[model samples]
Target: MENYNKLKSLVASIEADADKFFNNGNSAAGTRVRKGLQDIKTLAQEIRNEVTSKKNDEKK
Candidate 1:
């Protein structure tokens, strides 16, 4: 549960940062934001896998 909350907060922060960069209309900033967003997506996927594995273990 804590991991889930942490992942949610991290995603939200990345989204907010991306929005700020997007609003500024800077190409370099936009690129950085895109990279950051991608990183966040990867992290989220890993977290999801961890949670799913834990759930399956509990069921077993």
Candidate 2:
């Protein structure tokens, strides 16, 4: 549950940064957006692994 909330927050930040870069044409926002996206991808992979691990354990 906590991780889920963190993921939501990261998603929100990514959207905000994208808006700043695309809508406002702020160059600095682009860097932030890229970083946020990377963070999200890493986190998503971690969560996926955790879920898969649990499923595998259950089957064992």
Candidate 3:
């Protein structure tokens, strides 16, 4: 659940950059947004693995 919160926060943190990149044509913000998205992908994968592990544990 901690990672879930982190995922939420991560997305929230990137919102400004996303908005800037899409609405204001900021190249630097676009770079930051791209980096943030990659971080999001990694964090999402971690959360998926954590959930899968917990689910399998419950089957025991």
Ranking by lDDT: 3, 2, 1
On lDDT, who's better, 1 or 3? Answer: 3
Q: Tens digits of per-residue lDDT for model 3 on 1-60?
A: 999999999999999999999999999999999999999999999999999999999999
TM-score for all predictions? 0.68, 0.87, 0.96
Report, for all candidates in order, the number of backbone clashes.
0, 0, 0
**Superposition TM-score, candidate 1 onto the true structure:** 0.68
Best by TM-score: 3
lDDT by residue (tens digit), candidate 2, 1-60? 567778899999789879999999999999999999999999888888888998999999
lDDT of each: 0.75, 0.89, 0.96
Model 1 segments more than 4 A misplaced: 1-20
Q: What's the lDDT for candidate 3?
A: 0.96
Query: Which candidate wins on lDDT?
Result: 3
TM-score of 2: 0.87
